[model samples]
Target: MKRAITGLLNRLRFKQKLFLSYLVVIIIPILVLGVYAYNQSKEMLRIQGIQGIVKNVDTISGSIDGSVERYNHAVQSIVLNKTFQKIVTNDYSDLVNLSYDLQEYLTPYFNMMVMLDQEIDDVKFYTQTYVPEYGDSVQSADRVKDEDWYQSALKGKGSQWFSDNGLIVVAAFPRFFSDKATNLVYMRINEASMFKNVAALAKDGTVAITNDRGDVIYSNQGATGERLEAGQLQGMKEGAIRIGGIESYLVKKTVKQTGWTIYFIVPAKELSRNAGSIINATLIVIAGCIVIVLIMIWMFSKTMIRRIYALNSVMKRVEIGDLSIRIRSESKDEIGELTNRFGSMLARLNDLIDELFRNKIVQKEAEFKALQWQMNPHFLYNTLSFINWKALRSDDADISRVVTTLSKFYRTGLNRGNNMIPVRDELEHVKSYIEIIQTMKDHSFDVEYDIDEAVFGHTTINFILQPLAENAIMHGIARKESGRGLLRISAKLSNGKVVFQVQDNGIGMPLETANTLLQNDSSGYGMKNVNERLRLKYSSDYSFTVESAVDRGTQMSIVIPAYLQS
Candidate 1:
């Protein structure tokens, strides 16, 4: 019964795996993208909130400035009036009369001042001393000198405003008379009523004011007398600041006469509350998505685990030497492709395994036949040496010298069965080969060497240079219409390694062909053997580079191990 169940599982295939892969690939990316979008949207909303606060604060600053200008003009008019000055210079009987007459004359101005304060709410004046019937109370002359507004007004010939303070009169004082004998004038303001319009305009009703020295003069919510630290005040003219875990916008304007700074402050949260909705919505959507995704993951995992168990059962059948088990899938996807390819590969593997089992004797017979047909080069070398001896006996020195060079070339190439030798030995072998070629071609090549002596003994693969030299001469220079060529071989130490280069002044290869020679094995002629040897010795760090341009020339470089054989 277990074997029957196992056989049924083995027949199950690609559709299930493909569906799970699709879930992972598509659904996972969607979840990731949703999270990224959520974060980005939240940040954007935050920035927008800050900007809105700044904008609102800027508008409030302009309005405050306008109010300051109007208030300053009214004060200046009262101070510069010639009639009022005359009243100040007179004695009691005359001063009293003048005060009443001046009051009647200034009725229109007083009414206009009252109307202005109706929008802004409060204005008050304090004198140093009391006068009978000036109002209900006596503002003593001694108190004038100690008052900031009184002293500041007296010192100045023109009008000025001071930073907001908490001692606001809360009622409109328009143009009040100070009956003090002293020349000082004191003033007060009701900030809430004065900045009422500004508060009404607030999206979240956040605004405040500070003095030039960064003292909190007024806040919209009646918060007062707060002081900013010196470090916070430094280099701050007007901008934004983070306070009490919230960002606030600040704008400053100088009171022309008092030299006091007026600052408008608004909290970022209040100004950007509109944009806050966007953030909340984004977070909710992301959270919803996460919950949905978690549910999906749970479902997908359960289904995938079942499918994997089924596939594992089929795999065990094959592991136990059952080759007939096959995969079946209903969906077309990565899993389907994998199952189809695996089935095809199994068929091919079975064919190859059968072929090998049946032809073992034939393969051995072919190998022996190939070995029997091969000839050793030593026999040819001995025959050539015999000819050289005969030529030397006949007084043919040129023939004898060529034979000797050829013998030396073959001996060095064998190198006591070593696959690697010093670079110097390789160069000598190349030189000997070049000598023989020069003799045959009547010295049709100018070979230049720029080898570094310090790297002469570094080991390189045997016959690394000879084949390249032969190719440059035979297929390259010899094929050109001009029967002359320039072969330049350069080797140097660079960046802790030796770089070897061979450049020929022959017809260059096309860019495409040159690229193929370096990148593809099939396009490399003698290069295939060199590449295989290099791979056997080192890793991908070792390289062969070829640079060529049609009708220009070609340069080939080899980067090998720079160490001496230890």
Candidate 2:
């Protein structure tokens, strides 16, 4: 199965490969990321929503507890008042004056509390010091002593809460105000006014207030069958609550002083409902983004595939030596760079081909020259040999000896068909050429050799020495008059290499001109040919150098690696 799949992929073109690659590169990651982001965002927003709703519930709980606490302080304020305490005392016999004073004290206090908060329904003291007036809200001691608020206050020993009734603060005063009867101060608050903001913050939620005994005293959804049970809300400070086949988020807070638990009941799915639209909108945007991304990938990959196809076509043409083909692109992408480099390679390839053809033509000319070279020198040597033998017969010894040396020179110079020859043979060849030149120039130049005999067993490139000798004679020695011209040829072994130098005393050129020896060799067929041949055979490490000083002798040198027989 893997092999079949691999074969299928191998048959796909670059266009198909690029398109599929872009889909995998773009679509898969975006889809995965989109899914991950959607889930994470939904969870994060859900937590924030639950937190915000719970925070609002806690705020409402705080407000209710704070109002009741403020009432405790208000009630204590009138209780500690000296004049009102004295006026409301039972021992005061002037009934009209005492009652009038009592009315005066309590009326102003009542009006003040009523104006301060709507929760303040009324504030009253049921003290034993006072009797109830006609149509007054204050209760006499006999009618209210057994009341729940009064009983609770007595048990509490100070301020006490009967949330079903109100706050009852029943106290025993000293003999100065109430030695005979108990003094009681109570403040009744409106339940609806106290929990009004809870309704506002809850919106769609039910607000339930439960006492420490797990008894529900107040709920916004009064008498609803689906309301949270007291047992479910107990000890459940915060979390999801399930009851009666319904799920809800239960946010409960306790009023520490009153032992009252305030609950905000909300549907558990409310968080999801709030966040559903956002995740949906995100999914839609991501879907649109993916569509656009796929389109962009298709377009970009198509352009890439088209450019690659063009490059492939050019390569096919290049395979058959058609180097004129190329791809043109204005983009600064990798493909464009590849096409540019490929074009450069083709251009270089064409240049090398032209260079190779030119070098081959030069080689054929050199070979033709080698053939002519063999014929001309051999014919001259043979003619000279005949003349020398004839001259010897006639007893002309000097002429015969010179011609005999010339014969030997041409014979050894050819060196059978070998490019490499003995160093001694090269030296002898140079000697013969110099001897002939000396005779021709009327011995104007003198010849000197400092060759080591050890070098005779080693070999040198053939036909190398004769050209240097010719250059020394013609360019340096022959230019001078009389015995002033001198030619010296030397060869020695140095540091595992051979150094051959030809020095001449004549009209010497400047150092600047001597430094450009190889460059100037291009102007001469012999020097240029020898320089190219040496460079081709032995590389740039085997080279020539020319050194000269004005009015001094010039030296031309060749240095090459020495080869010893294994």
Candidate 3:
């Protein structure tokens, strides 16, 4: 699988491959962490919710215990009162005196005590001896004594709880009227009113209070029928469980004094709903971040790939011998540096090729010069013998002067094994050639130099001028009859380049014939050799312009790079 993916990647462009790799490297981690974090966060929030609910249950349980404590203390206050004990244990013969004493002392205290607690519904005292009925509260003693609560209050010791289909809490204590018997004090508070705050706090779910006997006492939802079984409440203190038919997360806190457990119940799905939303939101933001990152990676990779594609395209052209290709490398990264290096390498390769070609041309020129030198001696021997004979027979110094000019021409033309010579030497050699031609032709052609004086010391190819001058005299001036033909040569510098021209005022041919003469063939070696030699020595950027017209003039101009060897 890995190899197949790699092969497919190799077939794609560099930018696509880089974008894929970066996405995998970056996005995979983001996705993996996003999922992992989402799940972990959801679970953490669930636990945290359970903890918060447990605290809520504890707060409610504490409030219930506080209310019960206050009720019990109020009863204890009444039991410890000496005045109430003396009144209950009093031997008042008349009920009227006792009624007056109870009303004057206890009625105002009961009204004041009821005013202190909002949940306090009634505060009553049951006594077997005195004020059992109408003296303190009811009008008949039988009505009070006949009640079960009055009888139970005498038997019961501490706080007692009884409900008349509604939740109720009673604070009962003994009033020690005498050693043999004791009266009871009862302080009752409405349990429904006491648990109202706890019920309000349970807006999301149900809150219930159950006694130690597995009987539910009070519920926030007013559900007192169903209670947690002892088996269900056995081991689990806090967890999710089914109560009756409802599945809920249950938090249980047991009040030590009352042995009543406060139960906070929320639906299992409700506990996770808020936490799930938070986790989902986090995942969405992470996905968005991943998308933005992928876009940036693709953009960066595309820019780099564009540069590489350009380099590769230019290299393809270079492969076909077009070495003029160049890349605009302005970046500073490693890839940009690589592009710059490739450009440098191509330039170096082009230079090496040009150098090799120049070396080949130089070798060929040397061979041509060697062959020409070998063919020169026969002409020299015959010419010297003829010159000597002419001088001996005619007794004329012109023949000696012609022989001397020919000798100087050949000597300077050879130039002691150097292809490059000063402009002065070339002009002198051409002057010797013109002198020979003037003698041979009865002085019919005239040659003049309008050359720059500074151009004399400058370097040029040896014998270049002499050959052009010879071509002028032979091809142009010799064709004209009875005309004093003129050949002009000039040289100068222009725009950092060296330029010189050869002109002849004679029977000049047409432009087509002038161009045909410069082409190298079996009969056209001189112009071709000069053109090739100049191109090899300098660059191929030099120019050779030919201008000619019938019976007017012909001009052969050559431009080469300026190089002064000091």
Say which candidate scores most in lDDT: 3
Put down candidate 2 lDDT per residue, 427-522, tens digits, no spaces: 888888888888777887678899977777777767777787787677776676645788899999888788889998877778887776566644
Clashing pairs in 1: 13-328, 128-140, 128-141, 129-139, 129-140, 129-141, 150-185
Go through the candidates in order and give each one's C-alpha lDDT.
0.62, 0.72, 0.73
TM-score of each: 0.46, 0.42, 0.41
Ranking 1 against 3 by TM-score, winner: 1
Candidate rank order under lDDT: 3, 2, 1
Clashes of each: 7, 0, 1
Model 2 ranges off by over 4 Å: 1-34, 129-134, 165-180, 222-232, 235-237, 272-281, 290-566
For model 2, state the Cα shift of residue 59 in Å. 1.6
Q: Roughly what TM-score does model 1 have, to 2 decimal places?
A: 0.46
TM-score, candidate number 2: 0.42
- Pairs that collide, model 3: 134-138
Candidate 1 C-alpha lDDT tens digits along 155-251: 5444545553442211112233643344323335566666666666553644445555456555554122244444554466565676555666666
